[model samples]
Structures are given as C-alpha cells and as structure tokens.
Target: MDSSTTRTKMTVEEIVDALRDKIVVQELAPGVKLREIAVASEFGISRPRVREAFSILEERGLIERTHNQGAVVARQTAGQIEALFDVREVLEALAVRLATQNAPKGTWDVFRERFGPRAIKAIETNDMDYYVEAVNEFRRKTFQEANNEILSQSLDRLYDRTRVLIQRLVLMPGRAAAALEEHRQVIEAMIEGDAVRAEQLKRANIVSARRWFQDFKKFLL
Candidate 1:
C-alpha cells in the first residue's frame, strides 16, 4: 500500500469512527487502556489527532480518561443497561406515536422494503450482528418518519451511547428471532396508522429486549 494513500488526513470525526468501530466490535475490550501514543502510531496519525478522537469518544460515553491510566473503555453495569433500555423504551414509544400521527402516506414503505429481506436473511443465518443492524435501521427509520428534528437528534445521541452494549446483548441466544418478530409487529402497527398500538407495541418490544438483556447479563459482562 502506498504510504500516502494509506495515510489520508484523519479528521476528529474519522478518528472517532475508527475508535467507535473498534469498541463496538469488541476489538478494544472493556477496561482496556487506550493510550494516545499507541493509538496514533497504529493509525499512522499524530498524537494530537488521537487525543482529539479520544475526546469525542469520551463525550459519546464509550471511554473515560483516568489520571494514571490514560483512557479506558467505559463499563456498563446490569442496572445501568436496564435503565438505558427503560429510557430507550419511553423515547421510542414517543417516536412511534409521533411518526404515526405525522407520517406521510407510505412513510414506512422504505423500511418494509429495506428490512423485510434482511430480517429474513438474519433469521435463516442466525446472524446476530446482521439482526442487530437491521433492528437499529428499522428503529432509525421509524424515528425519521416522525419528522421531528429535535427528537431525532436526541435519540441519535442516546443510541450512539448505548449501541455497543445493545449489540452485545442482542447476540445472546434466542434474542435475534424474538427481536425480528418484534420488529414485524412494530411495522404492522405503523402500517395500520394505529398510533396508540404502535406506541404500546414499541414499548413492549423494548421492555422485552431489556428483560432479555437482564437475563443474559452474566454472559455479557
């Protein structure tokens, strides 16, 4: 690989993406120290750039800087996970309700088209990663249809902070299939323009996910 070609200028955003990917994929394990010099050398960037990325990651709740330890991946307790999901359930319930009230005709059609087949594929392959990605995509589309910029922005930040933990939890046995069914139900409610039912179903689905995570906490943490 050409050195210059492989070493493109990395903005703070790109650095954050790199670090986030590593954390999300568990390449950077929880509690692992992320030293600036090592990270900068590995990415072929300056230490300042690495520090910039670390700051963004810290803001996203993925890492924390300690006096002697530098930066380490943030750890989530079982109680914290439950609380996060509880908050997510309420927020998503509101989002679905708003979307149903204001969604354009066929607003959910894009979700049906994109997620329908991918969901089937996930079930057939039992691929937890793909299933989690699909579910996140569906939820994002649902929120987007609400057409509320403030809600979208707020939910986006919350999701970003908890997404890695969510992904890990979803990989437990039986969760992918259960989550697929829940997604279908959410879609059904949205399609029928039943805002009340949509909100209820969305909350139920998230609560179910929270329970699943709770049960699998030993395996996860």
Candidate 2:
C-alpha cells in the first residue's frame, strides 16, 4: 500500500490500540525498545502517527521514552511496583466502598454469580485469555457502578500499567484460585452492605495479590 493511503487509513487511535495490545500481551517485553521507524513500517503508517501513539502510551504508563533510546515498554522498579500497589489498594478500596453504598439494588448480583464460576472454569480449562477477560470485566463493571468518575479514571490508568503483571501473576500456582476467593469475599461484603468491611477486604485483597505478583519479579523484570 502507498504511504499516503496507509496514513489516511490508520488513525492515531488504531495505532495506539495496536501498540497497547502488543504491550499487554507481552509481545513487547518490558524494557524492550520500540523503534518508531519499525513500528511505523509494520503498521503501514507515518512516523508522526507512531510518535503520537507512543505519546498516548507514555501517558498511560505503558511505555517510556529515554534519552537517545526513543520509546520502550515500561519497566517498573521493585519500589515503583510497591508504590503502585499501595495507591491501587486505597483507590480500589474506596471504589468498592462507594459501589456498595451506591449500587442500584441487585447491581452486584450478576457479577457475584458469574465471576466465581467463570474463574473456576478458566482454571480447570487453562484458558488464560478468557480468565483475564472475565476478571477485567468484573472490575470494570464494579468501577462503573461506583459512579465516581475521578476514581474510575485513576484506577483505569493504574489498571493499564498493571494489566500485564496481573496476567502473569494469575498464572502462578494458587494465585488464580486465591484471587477468585478474594473477589467472592469482596462481593459478599458488598452484598451485606458492610461498606467498611468491603473496603478493608478490597484493600487487603489487592495488597495480597500484589505480593503474589512481587514473588514473580524475576520473571517480570
């Protein structure tokens, strides 16, 4: 395809999506260089568009630009990951608390019923993609129901950064099952209208999961 035609066909959003998927799936490993020219050529787009997409990814903490190195998939330090988890615990705790108090009647019932069984099936069948999608959907729906736009936006950004790490961690022995149970407890507390318990449980759950992920730091960074 001609350069101009390809450039016209591919929007900045499309470029961003492609790159984001690569990063999420670990096709572009942490700290791996992302060459602008190579990505532009691969996507059949101009360098400017690729740069724009990289800017978006950078803002989302999916990639970073280094002096003389262009863009690379972001590599979180141990300290950074710990700090990220700390912030996430607080934010997610607040989200669950608000969701419990403000949820429409029966709003969380659908998720409560579906999530555990889906997670068990994923584990039994060894279906990583479906498992990740199911968990992501549950979290997304919870944040949506919370009706706190600022908190949702913050969590969304953090989720983007931690997505790959979470996927890797969930595949570890016992982590998936543990995560399922944690989700169940959080949902149950929410159902019982115990906002304080729900928030504390949510925070503890995230912190525990973060520890599990930290155990795989050798594989990650």
Q: Please report the candidate that would top lDDT against the real structure.
A: 2
Q: What would the per-residue lDDT of candidate 1 be over residues 80-111, giving only the tens digit for each residue?
A: 77777878898889999998888877877766
The per-residue C-alpha lDDT of model 2 at residue 115 equals 71
- In candidate 1, which residue ranges exceed 4 Å CA deviation? 1-8, 110-130
Model 2: how far residue 150 lies from native, Å:
2.6
Listed in order, each prediction's TM-score against the native is 0.82, 0.86
Per-structure clash totals for the candidates = 0, 0
**Which residue ranges in model 2 land beyond 4 Å of their true spot?**
1-3, 121-130
Candidate 2 lDDT, tens digit per residue, 1-221? 78779889999989988888888778898889999999988988889889899999999889999788899899878788888899999999999899889887777777677676776887878887776777788788779878999999899888777777788788888888888888889888888888899999999999898888678788766
Lowest summed-lDDT stretch of 10 residues in model 2?
110-119
Cα lDDT for residue 147, model 2? 95
